[model samples]
Target: MASRTAIKRLTVEYKRLQTQPPPYIVAKPLESNLFEWHYILTGPPDSPYEGGEYHGRIVFPNTYPYAPPAIRMITPSGRFATDTRLCLSMSDFHPDSWNPMWSVPTILTGLLSFMLEDTQTTGSIVTTAAQKRQYS
Candidate 1:
């Protein structure tokens, strides 16, 4: 169960996201559970992931803002492993690096930027540009 603070923060974030959505990203919490949010990210132009619409989930801890959330990609983008928790500074894997000021837009924007790069990290996979294009 999410704490009252978590729920309130998430609610405000959701409203802000809807009112001023970020480019290439759309996210919404599950009707049944605010802790579980589903997101869609459209690959940026000129990238191997371009033309792709990747689906993913973010599971927020009960103590959000203070704790990071787990992020996983549901769609195959030839970048990150499907359904696996990605190791990012903003993710639960690196809670020590998480910032309470970081919001949903910030996280998703960072994810898109990372996806455009070839830097190796846990839960990340490497593939040729051609192979990545096929997935796109």
Candidate 2:
């Protein structure tokens, strides 16, 4: 179970993001569960992911806020591994590198940008990087 502090922090941060969406991103809870959220992020127009409205989920742990949340794209945005949970700087993906100072909005931006890179690493998801750069 999350401590009261974690819960309160998440509640406030979540509401803040919901009330003021960053021009390109919109996220909301998938259900009243509160632990699971669904987001639709539009990629930067000039970029390959541009014109794409990516769908994904963010799962907060019991220690959320104190610990980063896990983010995974459900639509296979061509950046992350297919159906594979992403390995992010935040989230359980790479806890060692996550910064607690990060808010929900910051995390979302980082996640989207990070995936835009061609990591050139095996474990990383190699999107249809070759499919002619089309947006979804």
Candidate 3:
């Protein structure tokens, strides 16, 4: 069960997302489970992933706002491994670095920025530009 604080926080975030969505990203929590949210990211223009649509999920811990959520990309973008948890400072992998002030938009924006970079990290994959373009 999700804690009251988690539910309230997620609810407000969802409303904010719907009213003023972030560019290149769309996310929605499941009706049955507020802790789980599915998102689609449109690759930024000019990037190798341009024209591609990546699917992913964010699973928040019940202690959300105080703890980071687990993030995973579900689509093959020649970047991150599909279905594997991504290691980011805003993710559960680095709880010490997470800031409760960060919201859904912040996390998704960070993910998109990181995707455009070539830095290797846990759950990240390496592929040629041609492969990435093809995936896009």
Instruction: Summarize candidate 2's per-residue lDDT along 1-136 as a digit string, tens digits.
Output: 6578777777787799878877678887666767788888887877777777888888888787667787777776667655456777776777888788887788788777776777653336555655515545
Better of 2 and 3 by TM-score: 3
Q: What are the lDDT scores of the predictions, listed in order? A: 0.94, 0.73, 0.94
lDDT of 3 by residue, 35-93 (tens): 99999999888889899999999999999999999999999999999999999999999
lDDT of 2 at 45: 72
Question: How high a TM-score does candidate 2 get?
Answer: 0.85
Q: lDDT: which candidate is best?
A: 3
Pick by lDDT: 1 or 3, better one: 3
**Candidate 1: worst 10 consecutive residues by lDDT?**
1-10
* TM-score of structure candidate 3: 0.97
